[model samples]
Target chain A: MPGVENCLQEAMAIPGAIGASIVDYTTGFPVATTGAAPNEDHEAAAAGTADVVQAAQSRSLFVSAVPHDLLEDLIITTAGGYHLLRLVRTDFDSRLVLYVWLDRLRGNLAVARRRMQTLADELTTR
Target chain B: MPPAVAPSRLLKQAADDGRTGALLVGGAPGGTVYLVRGAVTYAESAAAPGVGELLTVSGRLAARTWEAALEAGAGRGAVGHLLYEQGHLTQGELELCVLGATYDAAYFALGRPDAPAEFRDDVRHWLGDVVRIDPGALTRESRRRTKLVEDIFPQPGLDTAPVIPVTRAPRERVSMTAAQWELLVHADGQRTPADLAQLLGRAGYATVLELRRMAALGLIEAPPPATPDNPDFVRLPRAHGEAVNRVRPAVPAASEAPTVPIVPSGASPPAPAPAAVAVVPAQVTVASAPEAPARPPKLARRKPGARLPKEIAAEPPEPHPGADEVLLKRIRTALRALR
Candidate 1:
C-alpha cells in the first residue's frame, strides 16, 4: 500500500505531472508536498479549493431532491496545465486531498483519474 | 557583548526608550507574566471580558456610557475603575479585564514607536489612579497564556469577534470533550471565543483556541474575520453558500436503485442482513426532481382562506430540504454512534 510520500512519487511519475502534495482541506494546510511548490500559499490554496468544490456542489443546478455524498474529485484546466484535487475521506479528524499539477500536453486525463483514486485508497488505508 | 540581555529586556528597554506610559500584567501561575502600557488601549484577553465588550455585553453600561466616559471630565476616573466602583464588576472581574486589555494593547504597542498610542494623557488624567500594571510582566504573562491556549486549540480567530455558529446545530449532540461542549454553549452569535470565555467565566485564550480547533474539526464554524468596512454583514451565509456548492451532486438516478438490495440466490431469498440500510433515497429523489409540480399548490392555495398552522405556513410551499439540515442529521447520527 502506498504511503503519503509514495503517493506523491506515483503522482509525479505520471507523464506531464510536475508536482504533488497532500493537503488537509478542512484547515487549508499542506500535509505533504513534492515538486516545486505551487506559487499560491499552500493553506490558502487548500482552503480555496475546498471552497470551490463546496460551491460547485450547492449550485441550483445540482441541488435537486436527492441527497448527495461528499465531493470526490475536482479538476481545473488552465492554459498551461491541469489541477486535480481528489478528496480522501478517512477516519482522521481532518479530510485529506491529493493535489496534483499536470502538464496539459503530457498528461493522460483518463489514466490519471484512475491512478489517483487507487492511490487515495492506498494512502488512507496505510 | 553582555550576552544580549534577552529579548524581554530588549523589549522593555525599547518601551522605556519610547517613553510609552502605564503598565498591565497577567499570567497563569508563578513564571514571568506579560505587561502592557497605561493607556489601556487595544486590549484582548482569553481570561476575562475585554473592557469595551464587558461594558457593552454586561447590560450595566451602554455605548453612550463609553462615549460619555470618554467625554467625561477628569471626575469619572478610568473606564476600568468606574466599572468596578459602580457595582458593574467585582475587583476580580476588574483585574481580569484590565489584565486582558493591557496585554492586548501592549501587544500592539510593543516595537512600534511612530504609531500614536490609543490612550492619551488626557484620558489617563481622567482615569484617576494609574492601573499599576507592570508592562513587562503582563507582556510575558499574555504570551504564556496565548501559548497555552494555542497548545490546547491551535487555530486562531477566536478572540477578535462575536462567536456565531455557521450552521443550525442539533439540540443534543456529543463533543469529544467537556470543554468543547462548554465552548459551544457559550458561543453566542455576538461574542468571540475570547469574549465568550469571559462571559462564561472560563479562560479566554484557551476558550478561543479550543473553539477554533472545534471549527477545524467541523464541529463549529470559525468566527468570520472582522472587517470594519461592513461590520454588520455576516460572512457565514457566504461561507455556507460556498460549502453548499462543494458537495457532490446526488443525482436522482443513483437513489432510485435500492441502496442495499437483498437479491434471492439459487431460487431462495438471501438471508436479510442483520440491519437494513436506512435508505435516504426518497429524500434524494425529492430534492433532485424538478420543482414544476411543487410551486403550483402554494400559488393556488394562496387564493382563498389559507389557515394552516403558522409553522407549516412559514415553510416554502415546495419544501425543499436544506443541505445543512441533511448534513446536520448525518453529523448527529455519526456523533451518536461515537457515544
Candidate 2:
C-alpha cells in the first residue's frame, strides 16, 4: 500500500516534476512536501491551494449534483509550467490533495493526468 | 505586585519544576504570571488578543467554545481538563492554541505598563489542558508568524491601517483563504486587520500576515501611515449615519413656539401645549399637501345626481342568519335594556 511519502515521491519522479505536496483540505495543512522552491512556506501554500480549489467548487455549476464526492483533479497550464491538483477522498470526511508542479516543456499532460489518477486511487485505498 | 520576570526565566523555572502549567495575565507594571501545577489555563492580557476573538474570527470554532471553557468546573484541572475530555481539539491544535494565547497575553502585558494583571493559583482553562507546548515551540511559532508578516507586507507601517481593496486586471485574479475573507469583511474603512482580528476574535499576527499577503497580491490597498497631519488615515469609529444623527442635537428651528392659552371654567381647556400634542401635522403633511388643492375642488364640483340610487345601496345581503340566532340576539338585547 502506498503511503503519503511514497505517493509524493512517485509524483516527483514523474517526468518534469519540480515540486509536489500532499495537503489536507479540511485543515489546509500540508501532510508532506518535496520541492526545491526557494523560501516557500508550505503551510501557507497548502492553505492557499485549498482556498483556490474551494473557490472553484463554489463557482462550478457541477457542484450541486455531487454533494459529498471529492473533486477528481484540477489542471492549470501556464506558459512555462503545469499545476495539477488531485483530490483523494478518505474516511471520516477527510480529503487529501496532491499538488504537482510540472515543467511544461518536458511534461506529457495526458500521461501525467493518468498517473495522478492511479496514484490517487492507490492512496485512498491504503 | 511582584517584579516581572522575563519569559525565559519563567520557562526555565517551569522546566526545572517539571511542570507544564503557567498562567500569564495583565499588561506591564502590574501584570501577573502564575506558575501552576498541571497546565496553564484562563489567561488574559490587555495587549494580547483574546482567545474568544481568535476562534470566532478564524471561522474554525464557534463562540460557544468561550462560554464552555469559562463555565467548566473550577480548581486544579477544571477548565483545561474539561476541554481535553470533550475532544474539541487535537493535542497539536490545543498546543498551538495555548501558544497563541501566551503570545497575545505577553503582547498585552508588555505593551501596556499601566494595566493590572491577576493570576489565580488553582484555576485552569478546560480546553487549555489538553495540549502542551515546549517554550521553544511557542517561540518558534511566534517567530514564524512574525516572519510571515514581514515577507508579505515588507513594511510594518501598513500593519494598522484599514485594509482597502485595489482594482487590478481580470486576468490577475487573486485567491484568498477563508480567514482572509473574514478579515476583509470585518475591516470596514476602519480598524487595521490586526485590530479587526482582535475585535473579531482571531489570531492578530495571522490576520495581519494574511492581510499583507492579500495586499501584495493586489487584492487590497494599504493606506498611508497615520500621522497628526494625516488624521484622515486614522481609523474612524464605525458609526452609521442614522446613529450619528441620533446622537447629534437637532438644529434649533427659526419658527416661534406656539403659545398655550387657558380656557374659562365650564369650557374645555385650551388645547394642551403643542409639545404635548401629538405632532400629527408632520405625519399628514405628505398626504395632505399633494391632495389638498386637487381633491377639495373635485369634491365640491361633483353633482348630487351622480350619487348611487337608494335601491342600489339597499341591496339585500346574501343569505340569512337562521331563526335560532335571531331569538338569541333578541333575548340578549332585552337583557341589555333591563340592565
Candidate 3:
C-alpha cells in the first residue's frame, strides 16, 4: 500500500539508517532518495550502486551454479558504514535496486536485510 | 536574452522560477517537460517511448488495461494512481516506469540545442506526479549519459542508424548484459534504437547506450560512411568471402574468393548487407564455425594472403568503377550459393 515516497520514508526509519534510495539499475537513475549520500551526491552513489549490481548480475563468475538462481543482496562494509543493495524483482525483468547506507555500529545488518526483502516484496506485489 | 539559452539552462530557469506546468520544446521530435512546483515530474518525447508504450509493449500491462486507465484517469490527471488502484500494476512499478520513461524522453527532448522551449501554465501530465527530479540532477544525468556514450564509443550516427550485429563473432568469447542480449536478438539491421525502444518497451537512451557499448565491444557493425563521390561503392565486408570460404569449400570460386568484394583500402567495412547476405544460415555457419579452432595452423598460413586481397581490391575500383561488375557478380553468386 505504501507509495514510493512513503517507502523511502519507511526506509529512513530503519535503525541507524543514514540514507536510502531506489534506483533503476538499467539506466542508473535514482527514482527516490532519503538521507545523506556517501559523497553528498546521490547521483554518484546511485550510479555506483547500479554499477556494482550490474557487474555482479551480468558476470558469470558471481552467478550461482543453481539454475534460475539470482543475486539476492550485496553488502559492502566501509570504515564506518554498511552499504546494502537488495535487488527488487518485478513481474518483468528485474531492474530496480534498493540501496541503504547504515551506520555500522548502530545498525544491525541482519535486521536491515530482512526488512529490505519485505519492503521489496511489498513494493512488487502490491 | 541572447537569442536563447541552452535547453538545460531554460529548464533550470523554469525550475528556479518555481513554475508548475509544461515546458513545450519546439524542434524535430521535440517533447514536453512537466514540472510541479519547481521539480521535473515527467517528460515525454516523440523520439522516446512513453509510459504507455513502456507498460504495454513490455507485456507488463495489456493495451486494453492502459486504455481503460487513460479513459478513466486522464480527465483527472491520475492515470498512474488509477492503474495502481485498479491493481493493474504496483505503485513501485508505476513509479519506476515513469521515472525511467521521463529520463529517457528528457535526454532527447532537452538535449537538442536548436529547440526553443515554451512554458505553458497548468499543463500537468495525466500520469500524475509519481516522482520529482531536481532540474540540476536531470541536467547532470543527461550530460553524464552523453559523455558516457562518447567515452564508450564516439559514433554519433549509431544512435539513429540501424543496429547491425557483426557477421562474425569477434572473438571466441564475449560478454554482454541481458539488455544487450535482448537488443541483439531483435536487431534486424533495420530498426534504429528509437524504433527498437518502442518495439521492446525499453528506454530509448538505454537502448542507444547499450548499442554504443556493443559497438565498442566490436559486436556491432558501424554503418559505412557515405561519401558523395562513390555513393554506389557500398563498403562491403571482406568477412563474407571468408564466411563462404569456410562454409562452402566446394565453391569453385573459393580460390577466387580472395579476389571478390573489392573493398577500398583502409575502408574495411565491418557490416555486410544485413539480410541481403543471408548470413543467418545458422546450419551452414554453425557447422563450419568450429573448424577454425581445429585448423588454426591452416588459417594462420592464409593470414598473409588476407592482406593481399585488400590491396588488390582497393586500386582496381579507382580506374574503372565498372570493373567491379565482376566482383558484384561473384558476390551475387556467393549469395545464391548461400541460399
Candidate 4:
C-alpha cells in the first residue's frame, strides 16, 4: 500500500487533480492536505461537507436499503469541477475520509474513483 | 485589536520572534501551550483532554503496545513522534490529533487575558510537534469556537456546573447526536463538562458542544445556584465565570437527608436498582430530586447497628461528599490503570 504522502502524490498525478486532503469529518479536522484553494474557505468546505458524509452514512438513511454495504465514495459536482470524497475504511478510527478536487474538464471522475478505492483498500493504520 | 493583551497576541508575538518552549497561561484551570519556533505545537488545559487521553480513550492502542511505544520513545521529545515513526499513526493522523487536542486546550487556557503568562523556555510536550499552527489562525479558531458555544448556550458558567436533565420534557421524542447521548449518560448531575471529559477520556470541547446543544433544546437545565455559604463554593474556584458548585448533587435533598452513621464512605457504587436514591450516572442521578422533601432527622429510629440499603449507605458517612466522590473516582482510575 502506498503511504499517505505517496497516495496524495498519486492522486495529484491523475490528470486535472488540483487538491487533495484526508479529513476526519467527525472532528471537522483535515488530517492532511495538498494543493491550492479554489476561491472558497478550505475549513468551511471541510467542515460543511462532513454533514454530507454523515447524512449519507447515517443508519436512518440505510433502513430500507437493499445493499448492506456502507458508502464507498461520494462525488460532488460543481459548475467548474468535481469534489470526490473517498471514505477510507480503517480499524483505528472510522472517521477518516479522503477528499480530492478535480478539474471536470480535464479529469476523469470514474478513473479517479477507482484509484481512490484501491488506495483506501491498501491504506492500513496500526 | 482588543484593548486587553490577549494570549493569542502574545502567541503571535512569540511566533514572530521564532521562540521555542512552553507558555504556561494563567487561569483557574490554567495550562501549558507548547511552541516550536513560534508555531504552536501543542497545548493542554487542566480542563481539556490531551492527545494521550484521546489515544487511550478509544482503546486504539493496547496496554502492551502503548507501553512498548512509551518505552521506545523514552527520553524522546514526544510519544506522538514515536507513534508516527512506528507507523502506529500516519503523520496526517498525528498532526490532526494534536491539532484537535491543542485547540480544545487553548480554547480554555488562552481566554483569560488577566491570567498571568509564564513562558518556560525550551520545554517540549511528550508528543513533540507534529503540526505547526499559525498563531493568528489559532486565535481566530479559538474565538470562533467560543462564539459557537455562545450561539448555542450563550452561557459559559454551565461548562463547570453539573448537568441536571429536565424533569418534564419541553417536547416529545427528542432526537440527539451520538456525542450528546454519551454526554447525557455520563452527566450524573454532579460532574461538570470537564469532569465528564476526564471521566470518559473524551475531548472537553466535545462534551461542551454536546452539552450546549442539549441546553438549547431544553433537554437539560442549569444547575441550581450554590448557596452563599457553601464551602465548596469557596474551595472550587472557577477561573472562567461564576463560582462552580462542586457539591451540588442531582438530588440536593438526598445529601441533606438524615445522616446514617453506620455506613462507610468508601462503600462500592450502590446497586443500580435503588429507586429511593438516584446515583444513576450524572445526568439522571436524581429522578426523585423534586419529590424528595428535606425532612428533619428523627433520631429515634437510628441505632448504631441498623442495616441501610446500599443506595444511601454508599455516601452517608462522609461529611465531605465531594471529597469522597473524588476519592472514589481516584480508586476507579486506579482500577482502570491496573486493568
Candidate 5:
C-alpha cells in the first residue's frame, strides 16, 4: 500500500503545487518530504496550522447542540497562494495532516481539496 | 583523537555479533534499554508508567490476571502472550500497549543526562519485546515528541500542576469529548496531570495534550504555583460578576427581584434576553438527565449603593453586528420615540 512518500508524491503532482508534505501534527514535522519545503519551515507551518485545527475542533466539543464535528479539510486563501490542510485519520493515536501550497492564480481550490481528501484516505493505515 | 561512537552503531554492533541480551542502561531513577540481535525489542524507564501498569491500572486487566501471568511466566514466559491468548486483551491491544509504553520509556531512558548507559549481554525480559524499532528511528521519534511539546505548549509545569475547571460560563453552553468528560470528572483541582495519567492508566503524554487543549478552551486554568498556598483561592469566584450584573435583563439570584431599572451600564454588552426569548435550558444532550425548566433571563443585580448612569449610555452595546439584541434595542428605541 502507498505510504507517506506515495501520499506526498501524489500531492506534489497537483497542478500549481509548490511543495507538498505529510506532517505529523503532534510533532509538527513532515514525516516525508518532497521537493522544496514551504516558504517557512513545513514543521513550523504544521505547528501553526495545528493550532488552527485544534481551535476549530474545540468549537464542536464546547457545545452540546452540535454533534462531534471532525475537521476534514481547510483551505487558506492568501494574497500569494492557496494553502490546504487535510486531517488524515489513522488507526493509531497519532494524527496526520496533509498540506499543499498552491499558486492562487493557477490552482483550483475545489479540485485541490478533493484530491487531498482522496490522498488522505489512501495514506491512512488500514 | 578518535571519533565518538553513535548509539545506533552500538546497537548495530550487537546485531552483527549475534548478541542475545538485555542492554542494561541505568538503575534506580533510570531505565533499561533491551536489544535482541541488534533490534530494539523492549525498553523500561523510571520516567514513565510500565506497560503492565498502563493496562492494568486502566481497570481493563485485573490484578489477578497480571498475577496469573507472572506465575505462569517463571517456567515458560511471554506473560503478555498468555494474557492475550486468555482473551484478557486482544493481540492488537497487547502490541499497542507494549509499543506505546516501550516508546515512552525509551524517550526518557535515551535522553537521561544523569543516568549513564550500561550493557549486559545475553539477557531477556519476561514478557519480551513486542516489536523491534530501529535505534536511529527511535532516537529521532523521541526527540521529535519532546520538541513538539516544548514548541506547541511551552508553559512550564503545565502537565505537573493540578487542573481547575473554569467556573464562570464564558459561552452559553460548553461541549467536551468522551475522554475529556472522564478527565474532567477527576480534575478536582488536586491530582497533578501525571498522577491523573496513572490513575486513568492513560499515557502521561496523552493526558497532558488534552489538558493543553482544555487550557486553550478556557475550560481549565494552569495553576501559577506548583503548590498553591490556597488552591481554591486561585480565581475562587468569577471576576465577571460585575459585568453579569450590568448585562443581564433579569437574572434573579434569589426569588426577590432587584430594584434597578432595565437600563444597563454602557461598559457591559447586554446578556442574551431571558430564555423566554428562546427556550434554552442547560445545553445538556442526554435525554435521561432530569430536565430543568427554562430559567427566566438573568437580571443584573447592582451593588446596593451603585447609582444609575445619568445619560443612560444610549449607543448600542458595542455594536454587535446582526445581533438579535441589536434588533431588539432599535425596536425599543422606536417605541420610546413614539411616546
Candidate 6:
C-alpha cells in the first residue's frame, strides 16, 4: 500500500542509492523524486530515463517475438553507478517507471534490482 | 531567456512569499494553479483533462465512485485521501494520476506567455497536496516541453486545427506511437486537439504534440492555411511525388468556399475568385516550397483578425459529451470570465 512518495523513499533506502524517481514515460513528467541525481537535476534524469525507456519499448527490434511479452527492467551500468529502471504495471496502459541510481561500489546490483521490483509492485497494488 | 515580466512571475512571487492558495490565469484556455505553502500542488486547465476525467475515462474508477468521493471530500480538499482510504483506488495510482494530470495541465496553465494571473489566498484543490512541484522546476519543464514540440514540428497552427488524417499514406510503410494511433482512430476531421482531449480524456498538450508529430511524418493533413478564403478548409496531405498540378484544382476551391459560413465577403474574397484559389493548389506545394516567397499574394492578403471568428467557433457545440454538464458548465463559466 505504498504511495508514490513512500515508494520513492523506500528506493532511497536501498544500499548506496543516490537518487530515485517515479516517471511517466508517456509525457516524461517526474511524479516524485528523492535524493541526488545526475547533474543535480532530477527533472533531467527523469526525462533521460523516459527517452531510454521509450526507445526500448517502441522499436520493433527491441521487442521480443513472443506474444504479449513485456519489458520488465532496464539496467545501465556506468563507471561510477548503476541506473536501474523498473516498469510499473497496471490494469490500463502502463506508463510509470521506477528509476534508481546506485553507487556501483557500495550497491549490490542484484539486491537493488530485486528490492525495486517489490517496491514497484507495492506501489501499484492496493 | 524568459521575459522579465511574464504572467508566471506571479507564481514566483507567491512561491517566494510561501503562500497557500490558488492562482487564476486568465485568457483562452486559462487555468488555476494551486499552491500549498509556496509549492505547486495541483493545476487544471480548460484545455487539458483533469484528474477526475482521467480516472473515470481510463476505467480505473467508476464515474459514480469518483462523484461520490468528490461529494464527500471536495469541500475538505481530501478527495485523493478519501478515495485511497475507501479502497476505490491504490495510493500510488491516485498520486501518479494526479501528478501526471497536474503536469499535463500545467503545460497549458502555467506556460501561457501573455495571460494575466491572479492569486486568491487560502484556496486549495480538491485532491489536496499529493505532489508538490517547485515553481521554477515546473516553469523550466514547461519551457522544455514547448521547445520540444517546436522541434518535433514547427507548425504551431496544427495544434488547434482539426486533426485530419491524409486520404492515403505518403510512405508505403508507416509507424506510430500508441497515442498517435489512438488520435488517428478518434480523429474525424472536425475534432481539434483540444476537443479530442476532452472527448478522449487525454491531456491536451500531449494530443497537440502527437498531432504535430503526425504532421511531420505526413500522416495527417496539413493545417488550414491562414488565408481568409479557406478559413475552415482542412487540406488532406497529398501523396509524395503525385501529380501536383493535374488533379482537380477546383476541388479545393469548392470545399474551402462552402464549409464555413462565418467568413465575411470582403475578408475572404478568395472564396469566390477561382484565380485566388488556384495559388493554394495542393497544400504540400505550399508546404514544400521554399518557406515564405512561394505564396506571397496569399500571405499578403491576410488581415490580422480575419481568422478570429472561425477559430472561436471551431469547437463543437458540446465539447465534452461524456462529462457531467454541471461540472463542465462551471468550467465554461470560469473560462468565459477569463476570456
Off by over 4 Å in 4: A1-7, A24-32, A54-72, A88-96, A118-126, B1-4, B71-74, B224-335
Q: Regarding lDDT, does 4 or 6 come out ahead?
A: 6
lDDT of 5 by residue, B193-221 (tens): 76677667665666666777677677887
Model 4 Cα lDDT, one tens digit per residue, B38-135? 89888888678666556655666554555555555534655677887777776645655677778888878776666556666777765666777877
Tens digits of per-residue lDDT, candidate 2, B80-176, equal 4454446644332333355455554443333333333333334334333433434443334345445556766775555545666664523465555
Predicted complex 5: CAPRI docking category:
incorrect
Candidate 3 chain B, poorest ten consecutive residues by summed lDDT: B316-325
| Whole-model lDDT values for every prediction | 0.48, 0.52, 0.74, 0.66, 0.59, 0.75
Question: Which CAPRI quality tier does the interface of model 6 achieve?
Answer: acceptable
How is the predicted docking of candidate 4 categorized under the CAPRI scheme?
A: incorrect
Higher DockQ: candidate 2 or 3?
3
| Candidate ordering by DockQ (highest first) | 6, 3, 4, 5, 2, 1
- What TM value does model 5 have? 0.47
Give the 10-residue window scoring lowest on summed lDDT in candidate 5 chain B: B313-322
Runs in model 2 with CA error above 4 Å? Answer: A1-126, B1-69, B74-77, B84-128, B167-179, B198-202, B226-339
Candidate that scores best on lDDT:
6
Please give the ranking of all candidate structures by lDDT, highest first, separated by commas.
6, 3, 4, 5, 2, 1
For each candidate in turn, the TM-score is: 0.33, 0.40, 0.71, 0.68, 0.47, 0.74
Residue-by-residue lDDT tens digits, candidate 3, B2-121: 376677888888899999987777654467788999999999876688787777666787666776677677667788889988898888788777877888788877776766667776
Interface RMSD of 2: 10.1
Error of 4 at B9 (Å): 2.0
- Model 3 lDDT per residue over A1-126, tens place: 777787788888889899999988876778788899998989889889989987888865676566677898999998898999998876543378999999999999999989988888788775
For model 1, the stretches where C-alpha displacement exceeds 4 angstroms are A40-44, A57-65, B1-339
TM-score of chain B of each: 0.38, 0.44, 0.62, 0.65, 0.52, 0.67
With candidate 2 superimposed using the best TM-score fit, by how many Å does residue B40's alpha carbon deviate from the native?
6.7
- Per-residue lDDT, model 2, residue B62, is 43
